[model samples]
Target: MNVGEWAGLVAAAGSILGGGGWFVSRATRDAARATAAATEAAARANAAPAQQQASLAVLEATVKRVDEENGSLRGKMSRLEAVLRAFAWTTDRWSQQMHRAGIEPEPPHPLVEEYNRTGV
Candidate 1:
């Protein structure tokens, strides 16, 4: 070929190779970015169940603690109720003995007065 034709052919080859290289580089970069994004998504998906279980464990422990505290409080309340009932029974027995002995118990206690007033 003549020098001019050879030069034109080289220019055409250079243009083709440059365009091909650019296309390949862009495609490879895009593929790498897509792979990175997919890997991050997969990691999060895999961890979700474990994270959920940890959260549930904390919730279960909290519920158990509350139940234990409530049970302790209920036991305390029951003992207090028993003590109060004993006091009331002893007071009533004393009042009955005083009345039978023909001795008036002093001024009625405030609780007795309230009971008399309300009939409760």
Candidate 2:
């Protein structure tokens, strides 16, 4: 071939190589980006279980607090019930004494009226 033809051929080869290199570089960059995205997603997936466990721990702590509060309220309710029972017994004894001495008994207390109303 003539020198001009050889030069043209060399230019064509260089153009083809340049285009191929550009395509390969683009492909490599895209693959790297995809790998990085997948790695980030995996990290997030791995952290999800630990986040859930922390949430469960908070829930367990709340339940324990409520249980303790419930126990304290139950104790207060027991004491109040004992006080009411003692008051009722004293009132009944007073009424019996008044009836034996021919005096009319006093009216029922508000709490006694409520208890009688509800039968609770």
Candidate 3:
């Protein structure tokens, strides 16, 4: 081949190789960026469920604690109510006994009579 034709062919080949290299480099860079974004998104997606589960666990624990406290308070109230009933029964018996012994039994208070009437 002539020197001029050979030189022209070499130049054309160099230009094509340079363009192809530039395109390949750009494609590789774009692919790498996309992969990185996907990895970050996947990490966030995986973390979301764990975060929700942790929050739910905390809420469940709080509910259980509140239920336990409510039950304890109810038990204490039941015992208090029983004691009050026993005291009222004993006081009523004592009043009746005093009346039978010739002692002047005081008249019941208006509030007491009202409560007794209502059975409250």
Which consecutive 10 residues in model 1 have the weakest lDDT in total? 111-120
> Which pairs of residues have clashing backbones in candidate 2?
none
Candidate 1 residue pairs in backbone clash:
none
| RMSD list, candidates in order | 4.9, 3.9, 6.5
Query: TM-score: which is higher, 2 or 3?
Result: 2
Lowest-sum lDDT 10-residue window in model 3? 111-120
**Which candidate, 1 or 2, would have the higher TM-score against the true structure?**
2
Task: Residues 1-120, candidate 1: write the lDDT tens digits.
Answer: 999999999999999999999999999999999999999999999999999999999999999999999999999999987876677778779989999999998887898677547744
lDDT of 3: 0.92
lDDT of 1 at 69: 100
Order candidates by TM-score, high to low: 2, 1, 3
Candidate 2 per-residue lDDT, tens place, 8-31, comes to 999999999999999999999999
Error of 1 at 100 (Å): 16
For model 1, what is the error of residue 61's alpha carbon versus the real structure, in angstroms, after optimal superposition?
0.9
Runs in model 3 deviating more than 4 A are 1-44, 107-111
Q: Global lDDT of each model?
A: 0.91, 0.92, 0.92
For each of the candidates, give the backbone clash count: 0, 0, 0
